[model samples]
Target: MGLLEYFRLAVRALKSNKMRTVLTMLGISIGVAVTILVVAIGEGATKSVADQVNGLGTNLLTVHQGPRQMKLTAATRNAPTQTQSTLTLDDAQMAATMFPDTIAAVAPQVRGNIQVRLNASNAQSTVLGTTPQYMIVNNVTMRSGRFFTMLEAQGNLKVCVIGNTTAGNLTGNPNADLTGQTISVNRDDYLIIGMLTPKGTGTGGPDPDDMVMMPVTTAMQRVLGAKYISDFSISCISPTMMVMAQQQVTALLRQRHHLMPPFPQNDDFVVNNQTDLLARSQNVTKTMTMLLTAVAVISLVVGGIGIMNVMLMSVKERTREIGIRKAIGARSRDILMQFLIEASIISVLGGIEGVILGVVSAVLLASFGGWNTIINPMALVLAVAASASVGIFFGIHPAQKAAAMNPIEALRYE
Candidate 1:
């Protein structure tokens, strides 16, 4: 039979059961839409994580004082939760000095949310207290100025570098350039010698842009007094020294923290390389995305089952029509093609509509819900393949049942 003829017959078959077709299509459509949205969102989040990790060079390691809380763990007899205390400036400097090929710079950080002001302009932001080595550790570049010298840190100068967000809020205009300006942070005068390049925020902390950076000694002595260090950033002397550097830092911190010989988990501090951290985060997201996609696939499969059952009922209901067509010149293959095409048509249409719905949904969520949602081409391909697979798998039994009917007996069927 001609392609048009097969399509015409398929349309008639579907039209005869309008309500059923519509309901089944709706079920399939929703499944496709959800699959597309979930995978796209997953891929987008992965991309963001990769970018942030790459921003921190491969030789970088982050030092956190607290026990990891985000990942699931096996229940222990008595797992001690960590309170931030393991990191200190002494430890940071020691780490930098211990390994020859592994340690170029280390920057200890202490943070607090405080109000910053410039004359009459004011905004609240997280204030970071770190050394001149912070620039080397973070590998961040100034937009149009310079960082403070080591001498300034030793003397505890009241100089600070500000991110774009902090500057905009303090100046009351984003475009107003801030350099060599005196800003009052917590009622103390601070010279803003540098403005940092815009580094967007991520899940790791509040937006990097919405922060104020200051010398570690000055912030500890003058701004936020009386504090143990919370964390530190370690820049390996080079890529080759990363593992040895991590080991040396870990061993020293444990000894200082008084962790006994047999209990490594009792060590409160964690030394993480940038790529390792990114992989951990991506693994979690990957599992969640797969689970969501699995649920959608199950729904799609269920919808296919509905289509198969309906088509089987259709064959039984139109036994006389099948017989008439077969007796007149239609072959078994023609009947099979008609039914197969109908099933495929349902999936093809549902898949197309689902792609539109999925992309629209992702864009809407990204804009309104403030999520890092994105659509990916690979996600589209996956949706199409899944939908088609469902159609082909479920349509077979019904098509076979229809093709097997005998013309003489079907003609006699009421």
Candidate 2:
């Protein structure tokens, strides 16, 4: 018989047991749907990290305080003491001015969470106090008004810049023209001098567009009462000078802090090239995605096994029908093809249903759950192909068993 005839026979047989056929397809359907969802979430997270990294630029370097390990010796161990921040504003300025060839700009920062109020609206937000060069080093731009100037930073002005999310939290609009308005931070009203361009929620760290920016001097003296800056960002003159810049800055910081190294372990400050850090982060994300993909594959395998079990049961239950077909001059290959086609139809239909369900779920997650999901067309094609392959692979044993049955014995059996 032709392939279409075989399919028609398979469909009629499956229709005779509609409930069982539907149940048999359930495993494959769930498997494909889960695989699609996992891949969508994984890809979204990786893409988010990549975008954040690219936005930060390749030439940027970040310096932050590292853990201070007390020296231990064979004779005696040093007593544990409170670890203080090893970096200061002076270190940042020296790194920028002393190495003009390597370092282009420096943004020393001190950050803290503070309560902010605008009329009746109240919210808690991160406040970043940094030099005006934060714009250059971080590639930040103003949507309206302007960043604080060097004169304002030096004079410790009570002016601030707000990100879109921060503005929305207080003003009920993300794109509100909050520039020139005053918002109270810790009961101290600071004039909003600028509004930053919106940066959507990031996967890597704190939300970039959910914070306030002010002059470092003002943050240290008036807002946070911080003596030492938290961290600093430096932009190298060129990507080629990253290593040289890192070395020079490390040496400068070590010297300034009077840190006698048993090499890097004795150092209380950590300097990282942003690109390298980002690459490491991307690697981590890729690893997680790979792990999740493996789990999805395992689910597919389980579904395939379910298909095999159902096909086997169908072959046993239809033994008398198989005998009658063979007795009526049907070939063994015809019997095998009939069973195989049934299996294929079940899996193919299940896969299609799964794809629809997964795509809908991904859309819902992206829209209402605020999740990032990208439906890869290639993934859809591959998932269906994989399901079909699984059906054929699992169906083979049952089809062969049905084909090999002796017609006389099958007919005699109850």
Best by lDDT: 2
Give the per-residue lDDT of model 1 (tens digit) for 77-191: 3455646575777887787777756788888888888898888877999889888888888877888677778888778899988889988887777656688889887788999
- lDDT, residue 89, candidate 1: 77
| Count of clashing residue pairs in every prediction | 1, 0
Whole-model lDDT per candidate = 0.81, 0.89
* Best candidate (score: TM-score): 2
Q: Worst ten-residue run, lDDT, model 1?
A: 68-77
**TM per candidate:** 0.87, 0.91
Q: Which lDDT tens digits does candidate 2 get at residues 1-414?
A: 999999999999999999988988888888888889888988887787778887886599999998777665643356564266767889998998999999999999999998999988998899999998999998899999999999999999999999999999998898898988899998899999999998776654688999899999999999999989999998999999999999999999989988886878888888988778778988997898899889888888888898899999989998999999999999999999999999999999989888888888989999998888888999999989998998999899999999999999989767
